[model samples]
Target: MMKIGIVGATGFVGNRATEVFLAQGHEVRPVVRSASSADRLTIKNLDYQIASAFDQSQLADAFKGCDVVIHSILGSPGLIRGSVEPTYKAAQKAGVRRIIYLSSMIVHRSAPAIGTTEASPLVEKQQFPAHPAKIYAERKLLKLREKGSVEVVIFRPGIVFGPRSRWVSDLASQLSQGTAYFINEGQGICNSVYIDNLIHGIQLGISTPSADGEAFFVGDRERVTWFDFYRPFAEAFGVDPAQIPSLPIPEFHHSRKRELISAVTNSQFVQKFLASVPEDFKQNLKNIVPKRNKSSVAVIPQVEEVKQVEHKPTPVVNEMMAELQQSQYKLPFDKAERILGYEPIVSFDEGCRLSIDWLSQLKQFETILKK
Candidate 1:
């Protein structure tokens, strides 16, 4: 069995990678920064290496004699570019044989092409702030492969969803509450991948010789529109999909502007003044001009029952979840399957069920605590 070391194994993606490797009977070492985080992986029987990504001495020691190193580090655009070069240098010096890097689809695709696999020259010219830094990280890994013996594989996954995932949790929370909005009639398409599928891609990256020195996109096979995507979520919540309204872009923008102004002014009187204005002022203004399509009316709450459950959730979390519940996020899985043998183990419906089950359990636990 190969001896593998994982940097950033405490993170969401890294945790899944650890589970995959351990299940495959590989000896795994997880590099972590704290003992508490390392303790959480006890179930995997992984060896622990306490070291920060920037500490080359600690990293070199952690990487020594490992057959493969999975670098799953998360950082801002600047840090991603700056930190990767040194990690590659340390991995080579420590005699690591292979490396797997996780990057986002945004690195290679333009905003408009996000949910589509069809490549456009537009993608090449797009200037997303995060793309250049991701490109730099990929280049550093490739440079090492060319100059040194270590093989490198890069996997770029679309927006990730599954149990305990940011997207899934966000959607669940939104459906439970009632305050999610869609952008521009919610027409924007999105590509998403389940965490299990992403882990499958990573497993192939480590085991497949064809994956060496290459970059691949990982996502679901089916493409979905926003309305269709959220229909199931609303059904799962036992609510009518038609009850969810699409907010006009102008009104949404105006609401956000008022919130920003309130924060900046820091005067309770100013905040109250903003709040007292009709919540639909922007919508009313758009109606007077009659430009573009008549914006859909905001779905008023029909029953007091749903409102109570919605109000119980934290507002920020509820809003994010609502947006996810009403948004379309899917991915192109065919290429990942053909090249990396990747397949999503969890379907979108299955993900929703899992989230609902967790919410049920959480409620039960709360009820027990009150006694």
Candidate 2:
């Protein structure tokens, strides 16, 4: 058994990876960004190391004595781009043999063409900022692999979902609140990878020598659409997927106004300026500006036939959902199968059942419905 260090262990993927690795008789080191983050994972007898994700020295120290390091950090584009080089270098310093990096199929546009493969050209630009950021990080890792001191394997999975995933948990929460929606009548292809399948890919990455310096797409063998994806979720809550309400496919420019305001408000200079402003002045400025009605009509277009949704998703969420719901193709994992001997152990039906069972354990259905 090999010792493995997992960065971002508090996250959905890394947290599950730690548990799986430990159960498989491998030594597991969970490297988190803070003590609070460390508390997020509580597997018995497993201790986590605290370090800044951007610091090579700290990551090196945290990874010390591990044979492999799995990088699963997720955050802003800056954090995402900044962490790659430090992580690989730190693994080298810690004498680790290999690094498996988690990337998303989003690197190649949210809606890739049919038959898209690892070699398909990536989008030069994308609506979601994370897409470009992931592309940049993957390119950086490939460049670092030229040193030959460490083996780098990148796994690009699509819509990772299962227990504790946003696709499951967040959707459950939304569905409970009557806020869930789908665009294009939920006809889009959902290139989903069950969490356990993804973890299995990581295992393959660690053991397969041919996988070194290669990027592979890993997802379920099923050719399911977004409707197929959400139907099980809807059934779990006794809600008909057909009654979830529908949103029209949105044009990119439809959200430009909100996006501009978000960009300005989140700018560092604007934040600093707001901090320096007196409370009275800030309050006065706020009072002067017109306040939008709290119960304004939904911004995105909704089908007129279905009853209006009580709670609409935010502009950002709506746009993302629209993009995902508009997907027309699935990215193939043939390369992963050919090289890493990877196969999805959990079928879609089984995965959905397990995810809903986990939600049941949390009493989410009872708790949410009671509200």
How accurate locally, in lDDT, is each candidate? 0.66, 0.84
Model 2: lDDT equals: 0.84
lDDT of 1 at 87: 70
**Candidate 1 segments whose C-alpha is farther than 4 A from its true place:** 39-45, 109-128, 184-187, 250-334, 363-371
Candidate 1 vs. true structure, TM-score: 0.70
- Model 1 CA lDDT for position 2: 90
311 in model 2: Cα distance from truth in Å? 8.0
Candidate 2 stretches with Cα past 4 Å from truth are 252-317, 367-371
Clashing pairs in 1: 170-321, 174-322, 177-310, 190-330, 191-330, 192-330, 220-333
RMSD (Å) per prediction: 13.0, 7.4
- Measured by TM-score, the strongest candidate is 2
Which 10 residues in a row give candidate 1 its minimum summed lDDT? 308-317
Error of 1 at 223 (Å): 2.2
